[model samples]
Target chain A: MKQTQTLNHPLDDLLRTDRIPHIWCPGCGIGTAFSACLIAMKESGINLAKTAMVSGIGCSGRGAGYVKLDSYHTTHGRAIPFATGLKLANPELNVVVFSGDGDLFAIGGNHFIHAARRNMDLTVVCVNNFNYGMTGGQAAATTPHLARTTTTPMGNPEMPFNLPLLAWASGATYVARWTILHARDLAESIEEALQRRGFSFIEVLSPCPVNYGRRNKMKPMDTLRIFKEKTLIKNNAQPTELGIDFERGIVLGKFVDEDKPSCGELYDKTCRPSLTQGTAA
Target chain B: MEPAVLTGEHYMTGDEACAEGALAAGCRFFGGYPITPATEIAETMAARLPKVGGTFIQMEDEIAAMAAVVGASCGGVKSMTATSGPGFSLMMENLGLGICLETPCVVVNVQRAGPSTGLPTMAAQGDMMQARWGSHGHYEIIALSPSSAQEAFYQTILAFNLAEKYRTPVLIMTDEVVGHMSERVVIPEAKAIKIVERTRPRGRKDRYNPFEPGEFGVPPMASAGEGYNVHMTGLTHDERGYPDMSVECQEQMVNRLVGKIRNNLDDIIRTESHRLEDAEVVVVSYGVSTRTAYAAVEEARELGIKAGMLKLVTVWPFPERQIRELAGRVKGFVTVEINLGQIHLEVSRCAAGLAPALLVGHCGGTLISPEAVIEAVRRIV
Candidate 1:
């Protein structure tokens, strides 16, 4: 990758080029999703100096290490709370939690829901590859029903989490979903989420070819074809019907966006002594 | 507006005093979950932090609380959390993360009885060793224990100071008795309290290394969002704070972390050497057990057995050298604690067979009376 030293990468300013050749596998989609995030972060025109990225343990969790901003690669399932602390401690900071599906939904599921419930001013991007890619393609909380994995050789009996629906039910003020193939739409959605207030969640459907794809008959190209051919762009679609079905078209778009008061704003209004509106503690 | 420091005399529980102490120490962030014997610290922080322009969050669990505390500290805030044994157990994973990242924060473990929910409302000193090595992997930790509410306030401040100075997690090991017991505590003036601020990174921001040690073996911390573009991880990393998976990198990282505290034992270790000059039998104790041990030592002295109390103010480094030195002079040692035998093991190991360290202990829920401690001291005499 370093053979062409003269070529300048557009995202160089946002990347730790020294830690290039990241740990992502050959056909992994994390890099594409991460690039979208960086582009969105840059395009949003927020104070980059005041923005911090936090990630948990996984393929996508490694994104925090590669980011050029002040970043934290936290423990598994904990990126959300760590980001919450960063945001709440200093309201001036724009905290972003970027991690994989297993890290956010499995071990760190409780934190994800609570952060959303509080309507914290955070932009959370979950890269859903349908399995624990880092741990040898084991079954994950987001693994589709009857999907094959290392841990579930007989096919997964558990139904995958509908991430957008979960975020909706958990009171996220903004929610969207896009695949790695739709990088422009995903980046636009992320930029929109960054501009909006309150807890914003965006799920990127990325392919884990070495792990999830190899178990099924799908290869890297086949997964990309599914992302392109077998998806529907349905804006404001009902969250309950927003499940991922490879053969039956999976719906994707900006689903929820509202200008609700974030956790910090509400906390200042309610908990502080100089509240003019009211008080609940 | 309620000032962070309430400078006056007040009758309050140890937990409340500890909260006051943390506020006075410039701890502007507290993320905690409610647990028995330590809930007051969180409650007080929640009420007081916002008034002082700080932040207090009741997280979903102790793990999140610990993670949030570390995150707040990394975000340029002095952060803290309080919990019981079970919650403290949950915090171990993230506490290790804080240690690995060299993030400064304070954790208050108001320990209770049992291996699992033994007696949530009761007291125990069983987690003494857990505070030192509870987190996975071998790393040095600083822990302080308090015998009374007054001491709890001071120790909480000290915990923050040590955390800032060393750029590591500091544990305040108080138990159910001291945590819940109400006593007179005098909050000194803000100017009187010696608060330690974090040492900022010095040099060009573009060329900064987050983990490179400064003057006393502690790296100057650059909190998140300052534009240094620093990276922090739980994996073994180089001085630049990027992951370096080589075995050599692991050795350098671990050695410097352990050596940082080990080299400054004099500044970190705190103990009260009472009546040891003329005493032949020394009673090793800490936390609330020190109260009973002091009475026992005086009783033993009344009966012509020269005994003294060695009050361990800071317990994590274990004061091994002091124990070894005392072992040479004292004929024997009597260790007092509420647990079956935690610190006794340390005293015995440090004593190194030069002195016989006998344990007067029980399985928590109650304290070993002065009579039992005295009996143990008599056996040693």
Candidate 2:
């Protein structure tokens, strides 16, 4: 494994390079997803001074600490609400929640649905590695059915959440899915989502070779190859049918995008009469 | 500049007064969930916050409300949330996170009767111990017990100031009666309200450390979206706010957290004493029980017993020095509370056998009667 030691690395200033040698293991796709986010954040032309990132506990949640923008590494399953508070408190700030599937979908599942249902103006990037990577590969909500994990040595019998479908059904205004192999496309999707007005979600299918892959006898390269062979790009495809299957192909693309009044905008609209009345009085 | 205070006398419940107090204290962000006995605080905030250009959010649950409060505070706004015991329990996890990150926020637990949802509308001081030790961890906390609607208003402002000064989570431990009962509350001009804002980071962004102690042992704060890439976590962190999982690191972090409050005990602890100079019996009490204790002390005094009342405003630090000194001089002590012997145990421990500390405690659902407190003081005397 080669480490980048260039003096003038373009991402040096944007990252907490002093905390370099992050905890992500080699071949871990979380780093790839995190890098893409940084690039997207930099390229989106958004005000870095008015942007903040929040994350929960997990390998992917570590993304917040690495980003140089004002960031918060909150408790497990809580990044979404934390970001929600940050956004609502100061509407001028652009808030993003970056965390893993387990943190966002398991303990924080209720918060995820409600934030989406409210159409909170937030950009949520969920890195779905199929299992709880930080906790020695425990089974997760997004773990594929029949996939083996530390907690599920007999193979996970529980079906997983169709993340894109969940976001779409939960009233997300924009939703998309991409794998780590599609970094450029993923960054572009994230840029678009960041520019969107309401609740936006993007699921990055990343490999956890040390956790989910080792149990299934799939090496890092093998998982990458599978992603290349099985991911079929289908723009505007139905979100309910976009489930992942290792042996069979998986559908991926921009599934949902629409204009909608965000929570802040709607709040002002709904309460304008009373608010104005109180102010006048 | 015109002060933000409403500057008027009005009839309001303790919860409503608390919201007014928060507004006077410059609390611009309120994230809360509706729970019985505490829901009025949220309602008042929702109605008033927007009018004041502050933000009010009704979160999905108590936990989210707490998490959002911390988040908003981290965003450099004075933030608060209110809940009952059941909801307060749900907020414990995030409260610990707030403590670890040294975030300044106010949490109002309008306590109701409970082992688990015991009585939603009824009052209890059962959560006295919980407020101090509720969140799992070995760190000191600041909790204020307000006995009336007026004190609820003033103490809530004090809670936010203490939180900012110490850089810790401040708990307002009021009960259902005080939370619901309406009384005349006078809101002073905002100029009269002394608000303590969190100290912002001083040095260059590149050289700044979020957890480095300043003059008062509290680190300066930098809110989110200010271009300082801050990394905060529940894990034991260093002065630079980066995780360092070592025994030495834990000791340093925990000691600063606990010591910052412990060393400032004189400044953080507040108690009101009535007629203690010549009294032989000092009845210790707080929250709703203080009203009963005051009346009981007066009655006991009229009955030729030298009784005085000790009203605890800051209850968590326990006011041990005052109790111990009173124990040396007073004939005995009577501790009154809604729960059975929560503060009584603390009083007794502080008394250290210098004088007998008898408990006049009532089980949940009703307030302790002044007669019952008078009886307890009579027995102790």
Candidate 3:
């Protein structure tokens, strides 16, 4: 594995290499997803000097600290609103929120819906490991029903959110989903979403080998095997029909891409007429 | 470009004046939720921010509002948020995050009665203690109490300056009476208004340590989009801004946080003294209570009692030395606040057996009258 690691990875400059040998356990898919994001950011043509990454508390949230961009590792479940403020303050900057399923969907669920509803220009990447990975794999808002976690030692009885549907319904202009196995496609989808003019959301189903997978009797490779066998790539699949079931299958693709004025644009067009002109202070 | 500061005198409520003051202080971003006694500040910002090229966003909740404010400030724009008791309680967690990250932003709490949303529209100074200790930490904070719309305007600017100068969240702790009552507020011209921008990284970004304090205990800040690659978190961090879990790291991090304000009390603390020179009895007060205490002081003088008042503006550093000195000479001290005994306890601690200290206050939802203050004064004397 060390031999395979090159002295000069193409995206080395984009990463905080000194902060490498990261904390992710071996076989965890978070690194794969993070690599895809870095590649996507490099390809997105956004000015690195004018880009920022914001994250909340969780395993995936650590992505902000590892990135060489001016990043904010904010409090639990607050990356969305923080990125919203960053984008609104300077429209010239491309603000991306990279966080986890639990952080984005559980405590921060309100901010998620509201940012999408306002059609704020933000690229939100949620890595769905299916549990609260950092806090010993507790049950989470996105934890599948009957899936076992620390908090749900028996099994999670709560229903999970269909993330693509939530994003689409909340007015996101772009929505997509993929797994760590679909690295190329995930990177391409993120690149496209980064250029999209309004709120964009991409959910990556990454494996938490030690946390979610081990308790379910599936190793990291076993989860990858399941992903390769049970995944269906269906573009423009109805969000209502999108759900994850390893025994059944998971549909993955870009489901929504449409044009609508973002919150800043609408504010300018609608509120401009009523704005009284005054000399700049 | 339109002026951010409105240059004229106008009659306005404290909440509206706070909005204008934020604008005047170069605050270009406002993120907040609507809460009673504080909603007017958001309303005023919503109507005025766009006109002056600033941004106003009604966030989903108080937590998000504060989080957004911190983000905007980190992005190199002066930002602020306003809320009341319940909302202020919700903001405590993020407010701590702001402090740990050294994000410069102002939070306005136009207080109302509360143990839990006790009275939404009624006035109270019940949040005085909460303003200092609400965030569940051993960190020091700077809080200012404003008495009227005029003070609200000036103190809002001062709050922004303090937050920027110290690179921390400064609280403007006003209350319902001052926030709602309309009065004359003089708006100074833009050139005359003093604004302090956060110290930005000056030289090579690669070599810069984001948490390295200079002569003062504050590091120059580098906002996002400045290509600094800065990492900030709520966790205890080193000068490099990386989390260090050792006991030494914890000591260094927390001490810097507390000592920055603690060592600079002379620079950060502000107070007003009235007729305390030869006084036998003293009244310790802040916010609207100071106004009533003034009235009571005059009434005490008519009765030929040597009474004086020490009005606190910056309440957090708690002008302890001044109070201690006065306690050594004065017969006793009477702390006048709208709450049960928040500021009174601070006064008592400072007095520390040097003199008798008594509290003149009520539970909540009502003002402590001047007559009550006078009675407390007579009793203490």
On DockQ, the leading prediction is: 1
Clashes of 1: 0
**What is the per-residue lDDT of model 3 for residues B1-381, given as tens digits with 9 covering 90 to 100?**
467788899999999999999999989899999889999999998888888878899999999999999899888899999999999999999999899999999999999988897999999999988999999779999999999999999999999999999999999999999999999999988898898888887889899888999657998999888878888877788898887789999999999999999989999999999999899999888898889999999999999999999999999878989999998999999999888899899999989889999999987787888999889888977
Clashing pairs in 3: A278-B2, A279-B2, A279-B3, A280-B1, A280-B2, A280-B3, A281-B3, A281-B4
Q: For residues A184-241, what per-residue lDDT tens digits would candidate 3 score against the true structure?
A: 9999999998888889999999899899998988899999998899999999999998
lDDT tens readout by residue for model 2, A1-281:
99988577778778888788899999899988988898898899999889999999999999988888888899999999888888987787999899999999999999999999999999999999999999999999999998999998999999999999999999999999999999999999999999999999999999999989999989999999988998899989998788888788888889999999899877766654455445431
Here, model 1's chain A TM-score works out at: 0.96
lDDT of 1 by residue, B37-85 (tens): 8999999999999888888899999999999999999999999999999
What's the CA error at residue A102 for candidate 1, in Å? 0.2
Assess the local accuracy of residue A43 in candidate 1 as a C-alpha lDDT between 0 and 100: 99
How well is each residue in A1-281 modelled by candidate 1, as lDDT tens digits?
56866978999999999999899999899999999999999999999999999999999999999999999999999999999888988888999999999999999999999999999999999999999998899999999889999999999988899999999999999999999999999999999999888999999999999999999888999999999999999999999999898889899999999889999888888788474246432
The parts of candidate 3 lying over 4 Å away from their true place are: A1-6, A273-281
Error at B194, model 1, angstroms? 0.5
lDDT of 3 at A158: 85
Native contacts recovered, each model: 0.77, 0.67, 0.73
List TM-scores of chain B, every candidate: 0.99, 0.98, 0.99
